[model samples]
Target chain A: MSEPAGMIHWEAQDSIGILTLDAPRGNFLSDPEFIAPEQLKDLLDQDGAKALVICGAGKHFSGGARLDDLFKLAANPVHLAERMNKGKSLLDFIENLDIPVIAVINGICFGGGLEIALACHIRICSEKALFAFPECNHSLMPGMGGTIRLPGKISWASSLETILGGDMLNAQEALNMKIVDEVLPQEAGMEKALLLAKKMTKDRPRKVIRYILQALRNYKSMPLAEAMKEETRMFCELAYEEMERRKNENLL
Target chain B: MKTSFKTLSVTYDDGLVHLEINQPPSNRMNSLFFNELSSLVDELCKKDGISAIVISGKGRHFSSGADLDDLLQKAVHPEKELSSSGTFSFFERNHFSFLYFEELNIPVISAIRGVCLGSAMELALFSHFRFCSEDAVMGLPESTFNLIPGIGGTSHLIKLAGLAKGLELVLHGEMFSAADALQYGIVDKILPRKEVVPFALEFAKKISVNYYKEKKTLYLNSAA
Candidate 1:
């Protein structure tokens, strides 16, 4: 079925929903004044949508945040503060999706473009993909939780190196660092991402899947006791469901 | 026994800090190594009479990059895994302590031998200068596993090589020799194993004098 068009495009092909982002060229994020986090929530919450594949529309996935929008936000200091937190909250929406969110990053990905991919559970970038943070060089800081999430996903040394120095990297370099799953031919990145989404999503258990992901995400951030508690709860829930199935089969 | 927070070791003589990858056996980089080296550099920055810093490793392998054991541990028990900020593992928080090295006000150089991969290469990238022996192998191998170069490898790799070559390295996890490293800007110099330490020391002193000379301008300005 055809997906609706918006700032970030959405479509479902082969039962895998694809989210294509094409704002002003460079994938600059839309101005918050016209469409803030509300637009992103609407896209994610769209009914009948299961898995999401996020990719870029043009040559570069996201050159970075529309710095023009940043300057405008600075102009309206009070209103900007009100709008800023939503960016991070929106990231959580992506992270906590009932279904998986995969990123197929092709061409140049910088700043927000890259951060958008980091929100996805799986990332498949192309060899052509070039990424950079450049926030420090721009005399600004990373918003949209890049510092918190990238470091958590990659490593502290890598995160600081990119943040402190404004160096950019191509897809191959990203692959070695576990930045992307594979560096495929640019044409095949999205195809592979969709294939992965289908394979993982078929006959999947939503609650169990979410819990498993939550366990992985929270383990490193939380203390051992808390992580164990969450894991035990998940185990019990899954076990009880298994026992019920056994009873139905008259094996108990 | 006191854990001396050291992934690599060094000694001071001949007006040089000869750093060695002190991890016994293979000298594989793991969580403890990152933590030890970072803290050691932090402490070293405060000490006096330190002329230069040169990092090397023991055994045949300089470093096998991110320890596969570390990877297996994290993969099997995701629950026991560590976040970069978490204090559970020093290896987990491999932030570039080159800032601390910068604080030391001395030149830093790495004397490479054997294999340097993944986060191990990330450490070498930070040094303003590096010496690789004939047997040195360096690369970022994150893709072989289902991951990306998490540490500063991505940023540093591109800085040393152009975007095009960096792409080739990142995507392929291709291991290059010390000669190629020099051409790719991965290492500043290439020498035999016996001369690697001496070369690094000489390189460090050369740069150290320049560091002191550059800072002397501030001192003169203050006095004036």
Candidate 2:
């Protein structure tokens, strides 16, 4: 009922919730506007929220974590570890969400920005978008779950090149690597994300949508036999739910 | 190593082995196909001369995957399914056999063309690299028939393609193009139909030689 907290600007239109990273130029992640765990969880938990789209307010998705913040954390090792864990936890929460989460990338997406996009369920990018783990240039690695998630999106060899080389990937190159699901002309990234979200959730009830998303998460981590059995169980459960819903509607 | 098999033909060239699925009319995996495949891989594991292994199909297809008729028959007689875990299991020792490609330190390249579906797709997923012809078709079509991928197709695909797209590919049960396969990280390269084998060989040789050189360097560096 109340607006979600944090620097994220949350608004619902046509049953889709959009979270704009409302920060200054480059949308540096360490800015005060960064979405906290509680804030994000609150936004996603809202009722009637069919799908969520995360995007930047200005030219860049993010310049990634701030250098000043990194320097400050380096001076306090314990605080640094806790901050790293929190970032990882946020990505994990986004990944395990029971509804679709899409990242609409524009302009510069570097380091933590790229990690955030990778953690989402799907990624869409603008033609002018540039992606890289500039962390290597800063003499650090992507500590916010990028290294483990990168290999799953692209080839292991290419993942190394992207992370270690600190090279930039244009939109087409990202598409070739399958790092992003779709690449649209500049400024069309948000429209494409909305269309895809709409198509995915079309004619499906909230429960069915959630079930599909939850069941999919199992395929990634569960054993083959276990995942198969879980899939069958979900199928049968959905079947029963559909039957029950039909019966109730007829009775009404 | 014994070279004769009813379902496959093995040819050794220099340090590379070309293993072909020879069943006519789309090499379908039946009982004999599994037996031959299991024995061939086991033997190849012991052979010292091989530097890389290349797998392809004899006819138009890399494989049409499991024979539905054979699978149905076995399903009807579930008691025949072997089990080492004290449970009725279809993929008992066969699970290990399918995963053997990954266990090999040497490179395993799947030169895929035509239809690579069902269990065949699972087999390709275990290969270190997959090279396909432009006209190649690939997918895991089991979910369409009310069954899930039995032999690690779900996990391997999720590893190659991200979790969301991987689930969509299997859940939708749609066959895709070699280009789509490459985009999904399922195949490493797409070449002309006539060139798939040659490209696979070249890739295998390059990686195999580089692997040995890297190993020697690591050894020397560690010793120093």
Candidate 3:
């Protein structure tokens, strides 16, 4: 079954949730508030998706946010703030999700498109993929956590250059900068992403995946000592459950 | 200035300091190497007008990692080296010494060639930039011995390569080549074996002049 949520088309294949950017042309995000945060949360929750993969419907991942829509929204300050906040929160929600989220990027992932990809836990791109922060050329910057997330994935200097210089980086250059986790042959991004998602989550207990992802996330947000403590606690809890399961199996 | 050391040799060229792991073929780090490293860091801290530091092995291999025999000895009899550093264990002291390289204000570059495994790889990880030769082999390999990297290797690995890739590397404890290291973001650049040190030295000179003011990639993208 396919569920169309605003600009995004959501579908479930086994346990993986595929969210595709479906737009008129080049998958440009015309709506500043592309999808409501609650709408996305409900989609994932109702689908019972163990993992999520975000892609674009056509050849390109996205042409990023349409300039005309953004300029029109900017004419109304209060409306723009409200809409942008919703957009920001939507990406934030995806970043903080307990389950892994992968971005299967094929073509141009520019500006807002790159920001969305940056929010993912892993990024797999095809050789034909191209990335850039063209926002600088337009005398704008990424409004949706791009500045914050880009630096974490790559060097501060490279991120600065990428944003300010506004040059396109091919798949190999993106991989070199650790912008994407893996690069596949042209048109192979979606298949590789699905395979990777299944390999990471299939047959694996949901709780186990959640715990691991949480621990990894904590490593970034929490202090070293606190994160280690949480990891130890999770490990002990898993160990206890394993022991109980073994005992039941032996009895049977 | 003290230029000679048992396990390390320090040389000053212009404002740059080239630190070579002096011990022969494998340069396997032992107690002596750690001792010398601690003292060298102290000297480097005190030195004035030092611009950049480039670390490389004297011979073929960067290092085969820690001397297993020495590590086992220390593990078996921890009490023997208890008095070396107050309040901290030998491993802790060594860890802090490695940490010092990363905390330095000047750029620290590791010119790696041949085998760089276990603790040696950990040392390279502490550097700000790693320029590895095509023939270099690197890994954290401690898990193979039923142990984890004791000296900040896991944290650095995770920080540079992210948690998923880092976890795989440590869990498998397998040796990876320079190409793999570059892909993992562990190595900044890969060059021919002969050019590794010279390229690192030249790059260091260029960046050290305006390290703070300029973007690093500006210098990194420039040809040596």
Highest-lDDT candidate: 3
lDDT of 3 by residue, B22-76 (tens): 8889999998998899889888888899999999998998998887656544442
Ranking by lDDT: 3, 2, 1
Candidate 3, residue B90: lDDT: 56
* Every model's TM-score: 0.50, 0.63, 0.60
Q: Which ten residues in a row have the lowest lDDT in candidate 1 chain A?
A: A31-40
Q: Across residues B91-160, which tens digit of lDDT does each residue of candidate 2 receive?
A: 5445667778877778888999898998899899988778899999999876555455656676678778
lDDT of 3 by residue, A49-154 (tens): 8889999998999888899989998999898887777778878888888777889998999999999999987888999999999999999998888999999878
lDDT of 3 at A211: 65
Candidate with the larger DockQ of 1 and 3:
3
Q: Give the TM-score of candidate 2.
A: 0.63
lDDT of 1 by residue, A4-24 (tens): 134666666755667777776
Q: Which docking band does candidate 1 fall into?
A: incorrect
Per-residue lDDT tens digits for candidate 1, residues B117-224, read 876787777665667889888887654442445444554576567433564565446689888887876776677788877666665666565566345335323322
